[model samples]
Target: MTGMSRCPAHTERAQTSLPALGIALVLLTVVTGLGVSMADAAIAGAERTPDERRVAAAIADRLVSADGPLAARSNVLNRSRVDDFDQSALERSAPPATEYAVSVEVADTEIASSGAVHSGTQITRLVVVEARESRTLTPDLTTTDTVTLPRRSAQATVTIDPPAGTTIWTVRANDRVVLHNRSGLDGSYEVPLIPYETTELRFQRAGSIQPGNVTVSYDAPRSTKESLVVTVDA
Candidate 1:
C-alpha cells in the first residue's frame, strides 16, 4: 500500500477486541438497568414527600365527598344492614389504609449537591407522614366504647376525637338510624343508631370521612354453657 498500511491480522485483532455490537449491547444493558432502578426508587420514595402529602390531601378531599364509598362500610358507616361487614368494600373503598392513624409532618430537607445540568437549584421541602397502622387485631383488640342513647332517637350523637388532620371518619352501628349529620372532616359528629343492640365501630379514611351506613352487625352474645373446640389438621 502507498502508506505502509497496517497488517490485516493486526487490524482484525483490534476489531475483535472491541466489537461494535458487543459494546452496544453492554451499554444498552447498563442504561436499561439504571432506568429500571431509578423508576423503582422513585416509586419507593414517593411515600415520604410531596407525593405522599398530595396523595393524603386527595384522599381527604375524596372522603368529604358524599359520593365517595369511604362513608359506607360493614364495620364503619354502612348505616344500612348487611349479612357481614364488607371487608372487601372497606379495602376497595380506601386504598393505602394507614391502619389506626395517619400522621402528617411537614418539613424541609436540604439538597447537598447538584451533580448535573437540569437539576433543581435549591434545597427541597418535604412532607413526611407516619401512618400508625391499627394494631387492634394483630395481637389484641384495644378499642373501648360505651353507648347510652334513647331507644328511638332518630339521631344518635357520637363525639369522636381522632388524631389531628384526620380526613375520614368511619362509624358502624349496632342497630337503626333516623338521620346522620353530613358533617365536615373534623372527627366529631352526632349519629343515630338503631334501637336495642350494641354496635362495633371503626374509623378510617383515604382522603375524607367514609360515608355512614346502618347495619345490624352487633356482636353476638356468648352463652355460659358454650365450650371451645380445637382441631388440628395433619
Candidate 2:
C-alpha cells in the first residue's frame, strides 16, 4: 500500500475552536459597555451634595410660613413684602440661607438671594400673592337700614358723622354688634371684622340717616396664584 492520506483530527478541532472564541469576544464587549455606564452614573451622583437639597427645601418652607417676612398668611405672600424682599430679608427670614448660595424666585423673577446661584438643587412651591387696597363705601341708609360691603376685609374704619335729629346709638356688622353707645356714637372708629364673611353694616337710629354720614374704609386683598422657587448651591 502506497502512503495513504489520513484525515487529521486536529484540523476538525481547530474549526470548532473558532466559533467558541467569537462568542467569548462578544460577551467581553457587552460586559465592558455595562461597566462604563455604571461608572459614569456613579461619577455624576458623587458630584451632587446632600446639603444643597436640604438647604433649598428648608428655605422654601420657611418663606411660605405664616410668620415669614414675606407672607401675610400661610402660603400667601404679601405683594409689598415680595417687592421688598432682598438678600438681607432672606437671611433674616431663613438663617440657613446665609451659609449657602441661595436664590429665591417667584414667577420666574428673582426676588431675593443670598449669593449668586447659577445651578444647584431647587425646591418649588405653589403659593398665592396678595395685594391689599384701601377702598371707601358710603351707602344710602334711607332706602334700607342695612349696607353690604362689596369685598371682604379684616378691618375697617367706620366714621359716624350723623346730622342733627339722627341719634345713632349702635352699629351692627353682619348681625354682630361692633360698636354701641348708650348716649350716642360719633367720630371714626376702628372695627375688626371677619375676612371670610360678607359684612352688612346696620344702624339703629330714631331719625333718617343721609349718605356720606357713615363712611367705611377697608383694605381689600387681591390674590393671584404663583410659583415660588428656591435654589441652593454649596
Candidate 3:
C-alpha cells in the first residue's frame, strides 16, 4: 500500500507538466535560432556595400581597357554599343539586377609635335551606359536588291507596293539627292525629282518596336501597285 501511495490525479498532472516543459523548450530554441539568423543577415548587409562598389569599379575598368590607351580617358560605358565581349564580362562581374550609370570618354591626348592639348573632352563617342535586368533583342535584318539602277534620280518613289509599316526606304539617283523616305509609320512620301541615270532602290528595314525579323523587297515601279514586300520577324 505504501509503494503505490501516489494519487492517480498526481501522476496525470506530472505527465502533463513534462510535455508542457518540453514544448516550451522547443519554442525557445526556435526563437533563439531566428534571432541569430537575423543578426547574421544584418552583419552581411553591412559588409556587402563596399564590396559591391569595388566590383562595380572593376567592371568599369575592364570596359575602359577595350579602347586601349584611349580607354583611360573614358569614364563611362554605354549599354547600346556593347559588343559581345563587353556584354559577357558585364554579365559575369556585375549582374543586371544592380543599376548603374556609367559615363565614358576618351582622355585628352598630346598632339606630340605641337603639344596641342587635346583634352579628353567627351566627344561624339560619348556613351550613356546603363545596367538593366532585361534586354531587347535586335531583329535580324536581310537586304536584297530588287533593281540596281545605272542612274538613280535623287527624287522618285523607290518603293513599290511596300509591306505594312515600312519606312526609311531610300532611292538615290546620281548618288546625291534624297529621292524618298517612307520613314514615318503610315502615309505616302512625295518625291518631286525626275528619274535620272540607273536608279537604285534600297528598301532597308528601319527596325521594329518588338522582337522580330523584317524582310523588305524592292519591286520595280512598273510591276504592280502593291509591289514592295517588307517582312518583320521578332
Q: Pick the candidate with the highest TM-score.
A: 2
Candidate 2 lands at a TM-score of 0.79
| Backbone collision tally, model 1 | 27
Most accurate candidate by lDDT: 2
Per-model TM-score, in order, reads 0.21, 0.79, 0.28
**lDDT digits (tens) for residues 27-111 of candidate 2:** 9999999999999877775676577887888889899999988898899999999999999889988998878889999989999
Of candidates 3 and 1, the better by lDDT: 3
lDDT (Cα, tens digit) per residue for candidate 1, span 137-234: 11111233223333322344444433445443344454333223345334335555553444434433333221232112122221111111111110
- Misplaced by over 4 Å in model 3 are 1-11, 57-81, 87-234
Of the pair 1 and 2, which is ahead by lDDT? 2
Give lDDT: candidate 2, residue 40: 89
Clashes of each: 27, 0, 30
By TM-score rank, best first, the candidates go: 2, 3, 1
The TM-score of predicted model 1 comes to 0.21
State the weakest 10-residue window (summed lDDT) of model 2.
1-10
lDDT of 3 by residue, 102-194 (tens): 222222221111112222112123333322232221223343423343222333322233345645455443354454545542333443444
Scored by Cα lDDT, where does model 1 land? 0.35
